[model samples]
Target: MQTSTIKLLRALVCMMLMNSLNAVADKVVTDSPVTDLSQFAYPVQDAKEAFKREQYAFVGIQLHDTLETPGVTAREVEVWSTQPVEPLNTRWQSFANIEEDRTALLRLRQYANRYNLMTLKLLKEKRRSDTMRYRY
Candidate 1:
């Protein structure tokens, strides 16, 4: 009777541990945000141009797609993250053209705000410059 009781207690303890581990696994699986890579279909060339211009916002969008795509080697994301950015002034020369690159530009603008990269004053200045350029 003593041996049977000890074995039962051991089995109960093991089951409890397994249940706790399963719960932890479920929490970990559910905690992360679900991102659908299919939603990020922006052209790679556009992303490259944006990155060359030091537009971190656009680059981040591209990074999102690149990071989420299956079979994309880890080395690719490492390269993207380590890519150098040009001087801020050189990169901030022009605002995104809304008509031509609407969605991509919109995503860039959204990320720029979220990351606090571009301030309201700077955005206004960019808009003013864009207007001045067209004034002839």
Candidate 2:
């Protein structure tokens, strides 16, 4: 009876771990940062052109004088402050340029890595517990 109860508990734990990992994985896979064209229109358009051409270095160059125009930065900030807080993929905020592309991609990779690390940690704990259980 005790053995059955232990097995059931272990199964429950495994199920819960898998469910949590699945949620993380799902979030990582579907994560995409969206741009608000209203505020970031010109910058995004310029960045997209450079990005598509594979001239990443020219991204900043293209947006060099973007903020030189008065009220542009303030307008962007005002619009951004009103938007919902995003969990990830919001790169075009403070700095507006092509480098934000790299930042966004890195954020996605970070999420994937975090999920992998969590899974590994859980697996290591399970293995340690199983080995200790047998020794007893």
Candidate 3:
């Protein structure tokens, strides 16, 4: 009887140890490394290098003396280029010229004051009804 009791106690202890081991195994946890933008196939750092450069071609015109007549002395004229050169192209090339060979003229027939200007005229190279001329 003593030997049987010892065997039974040993068996119970073994069973308890196995159940505790199973519980611990079921509760086990694991973790992976933290993910960042630099680890992907297309990393976020590559966008900083991709950029573009734009060039604007402009022209200005000033009258010899408009203050005495219409109070407006000079005016600036701007025209967009057909083909704008990019930064990757030749750096020493000249800017594109005006397509239409005409002069923009501003007429000062009347003057309100020595500083105020009036009566502006814009002449087109070709006669066109769409052309507009105004003053501020």
Candidate 4:
């Protein structure tokens, strides 16, 4: 009789634990919000990494012919956590124009990739002109 009672008590305790675990699993969130995706960002690790990450916002800067790509300049831009920088695949497509070599991404090795001078190519300007013509 004593052994049977102990077994029953153990089973009851396990059942109660399972119920509590199920409740916790149901309440946990699995997705980040649309506008506040920073929740999923990796934490800013070091000062050097932070500075490098911050430079990503200036990836396509130009000054010679007022042709600055103005990255991170125009509003309605997407930005997650600055401190914890992340990767991206940005492009500008229109009815008649589609950017081909466009890249505004933050790489793991920030300095090595930031100044690749990709925007120096004439492809983007050509695409923009076509887009303007289509727009008008």
Error of 4 at 27 (Å): 1.2
TM-score for candidate 3, please give it.
0.22
> lDDT for every model?
0.41, 0.41, 0.27, 0.34
Candidate 2 backbone collisions, by pair? none
Clashes by residue pair, model 4: none
By summed lDDT, which 10 consecutive residues of candidate 2 come out lowest?
55-64
Task: State candidate 2's TM-score.
Answer: 0.28
Residue range 1-136, candidate 4, lDDT tens digits = 9999999999999999999998764433222111132332432323234434433222332222332322233321233113322322212211111122122112212422332222222224545776899774
- Give the CA lDDT, 0 to 100, for residue 26 in model 2: 60
lDDT of each residue in 1-136, candidate 2, tens digit only: 9999999999999999999999976654444243432333343344345335533221111233332212123343343233321222233553443344554444434442443333334434655877899784
Candidate 2 stretches greater than 4 Å from native:
34-136
For candidate 1, list the clashing residue pairs, or say none.
none
Sort order, TM-score high to low: 1, 2, 4, 3
Candidate 1 lDDT, tens digit per residue, 11-112?
Answer: 999999999999976664343132222333444544445545855331232331132222223443354344533211112233322224344445444443
Q: Compared with the true structure, what per-residue lDDT tens digits does model 3 show for residues 1-98?
A: 99999999999999999999987644431111111212222212211122112222121222222112223332421122333211111112313211
> TM-scores of the models, in the given order?
0.29, 0.28, 0.22, 0.25
Clashing pairs in 3: none
